[model samples]
Target: MDGLSGQGPAAADRADTAIRAIGLIKDFGDTRAVDGVSLAVPRGTIYGLLGPNGAGKTTTLRMLLGIIDPSSGSRVVLGHDRPIDAAPQIGYLPEERGLYPAMHCREAIAFMGALRGLSLPEGRRRADALLAEHGLGEWARKPIRTLSKGMAQTVQLLGTIVHQPRLIVLDEPFSGLDAINQARLEEMIRTKAREGATVIFSTHVIAHAERLCERIAIIAKGKVAFEGAVDDARAKLRPIVRLRTRNADGPWRSAIPAGTRTSGRDWEFELPESGPEPLLRALIDGGAGIETLAIERPGLHDAFVAIAGDAAAAAMKQEVPQ
Candidate 1:
């Protein structure tokens, strides 16, 4: 709550932005799915939309992509005030997977590229090369129905990138990937960013956003709760100091804060705003022998739980993609 944000893009920022949404809202019948969300994603960077399921992450993405119109507000994608007009240069992979079951993996990838205007022959050549590079050469001729769920997902991801679009939008891309494949996907995102493509991905998984995003917007109750750099998110919570003492009980114990948690000889508490030096001096003057001292900053996971609340944390269940 300390760093809540929904900054609108300034006029001078338009030239460098890959996508800009100002007070986007969507309504399905009487239900308001998204409300007053604003974001400015810079070109050639990775941005993340993070939230629990049913938190309107998908709806916001859909409105931004021109797949659905916003009931209020507006979005601009790749210089097109009308997002659909810029469709040729944008690659989108929706949450639900759909592909022709009988099509061979190679042909399937090429077909996806063709839809984006890549010639079939050129698409096929690029597909083969991409498959080989990604350890899927042998699966090229296999039918989509024959591959396992993980393998099928990989094929779809390959297809998503075959055309090398200027902007790529992926919804819940890591939902079903195992550890290895997830790492591969992370690397692929980095590679795309290095090649100057702007990418936006939505996920409930905070780790992916922490690792890959240059900036992020955290959605809760269909609104932007927090948006900024990952480091900024983590800074909302104060760093904690963990201390170990040689003495079991001493006058120094009185110097500890009221909320300090103790375990055996260790004491942990948040570093006060006045700073840790005063506390350290107090403990030392009280004759406590400091065995170890550590100050640790909160990670994104901790900051997320702090900012989004316990309900959101429980909803994630710390799910590792299957």
Candidate 2:
């Protein structure tokens, strides 16, 4: 892909969000799960909270949702200083699955809706509608125990949004979902955002962020390693381009250009800061069949590796002090 200029939105168009957390810290006994983390989520966009399992993603969400209080620091969700007071405007789907096993799907979902202040009739109506929308209409009366894991997860997801909260926090919303269901969930999220709700979710899956999130906050070792637009995050990475050709082993191997290197058919390379047009022309002149040429901005996974690797190396160096 030819270098496309800043793709998404103008700087001014970037929505000004109200999620602010200053030195937010949460601990579990001797373990510090969230260590002085701060973040700002823009309004009217999909934000992703990403990290490996046991990396405090769940703990952080709990703190934000008022299910657990922070050990220290402060947080303001949708301008509400008190997290509990912010509950009415926030919808949270927890990491752990929980629905009354004995209750019918619609009833269980409606009950969750009630917790968000929806009345019985209103909750039931929405529950019935979402059950059908999510393809669980036929199973609406089935007990939670009788539903498949995917089905129950769908019900739980419906419960999260049934009351139409202004901000939706989904914890591993794609977990246990097959590709088809995952696609459906992704579509659901996009639709929700198009309808003007700010959706933030936590995931270990990086591609989800690449595809859907407008902004991402990546946490490693209980701290944020990076937070910004996907393109901006990628831009911070050293420039590398990937190219594919008709011949895997070609003469180009011996004639590698400066700021470039070859690895079989693949290359981890860059061009002169001046421009890439010359190099682009050189490949064509060399009879090298260029099937695909992509100017790569390192992805979230690459950034994760670079950031976490550096941190680990620094920690190891500290441990070995002279």
Candidate 3:
């Protein structure tokens, strides 16, 4: 296995790597869908590929899954040099969902397992158990068309994992699901990772990545803007201080940072290098009549805006109608 730095993996890390893509590029005519993207997903971890629509997230996933070949670069999946060589050990749920409309839920799931070499009988058994576990026991025998969109999507996901692949890849797995189903899927993802399967999912929704990802790669305009631990991303930006004071012209205003901005009586600014405690004491001592004050640490959303810039983040937000 190769490390993220393009070197041989260390002894302690060799066995922990599940997926590694280095300088992956994909071109469609004049456009480059994925531009020299590189990522390493560790085993038993939930990694997220985050970007707005047309940001090349899907293209990169496809290349990693061997559904499409990259114009250049290399990837290793589950110790295999090529993704197809490790296909049986990988479960992939594409962004575009598809299932036989006339097939029974159990049969559909079993068929998916069969593709990964599970026996029909065992596949059916596992499918039934999985359905029961996911609160769809009664729907096992029902036709796919009979289930709601959420239920069908759930069935598709169950099929993807019925064979217990060592690595699971989901492209836009959260698309179109309501809040409840989204939460359910989140739990399922956590469960899979807990069971020691590496899970990689792509989404434009910052909330999902913030909630579920230990590591994430933020893609913008077909380029990876940031990739690393979620905490590291958030750490790149300073904490914000929001305050509302009755005495807007008080001497304590000097405590505000140089780049501070005001909205009516409210003042919002990044904390200074000296931190917020000094400013708080200054405001109190100067009789600034503070009505409210808060120091907020930046989250993944703020990190995205900071790293990808306001224009790209705005474009991403607008891309997802959800």
Tell me the spans in candidate 3 whose CA falls farther than 4 Å from its real position: 1-12, 263-265
lDDT of 2 by residue, 1-322 (tens): 2223454442323235647677889988999989988888887789998777666778888887778899998877786778788798888898788998999988988999999999989999999999888667887789999988888888888899999988999998887787777898899999999988999999877778779999988887889878888877776676666787777655555444566666667676764464567667767777678888877667766766676565543443343313
- Model 3 scores a TM of 0.93
Better of 1 and 3 by lDDT: 3
Tens digit per residue, CA lDDT, model 1, 1-322 = 2222433455446568999999999989999999899998999999999999989999999999999999999898998899999888998999999989999999999999999999999999999999999888998899999987778988999999999999999999998888888999999999999999999999999889989999999998899989888899999999999999998788888888889999999999998887888889878988889999999999888988988898887787555454
User: Distance from true position, residue 167, model 1, in Å?
Assistant: 0.9
Error of 1 at 262 (Å): 1.0
Report the Cα lDDT for residue 246, model 1.
90
lDDT of each model, Cα atoms only? 0.91, 0.79, 0.91
RMSD in angstroms, all models? 4.8, 8.2, 3.0
Clashes of 2: 0
Better of 1 and 2 by lDDT: 1
What is the per-residue lDDT of model 3 for residues 71-98, given as tens digits with 9 covering 90 to 100?
Answer: 9999888877778999999999999999
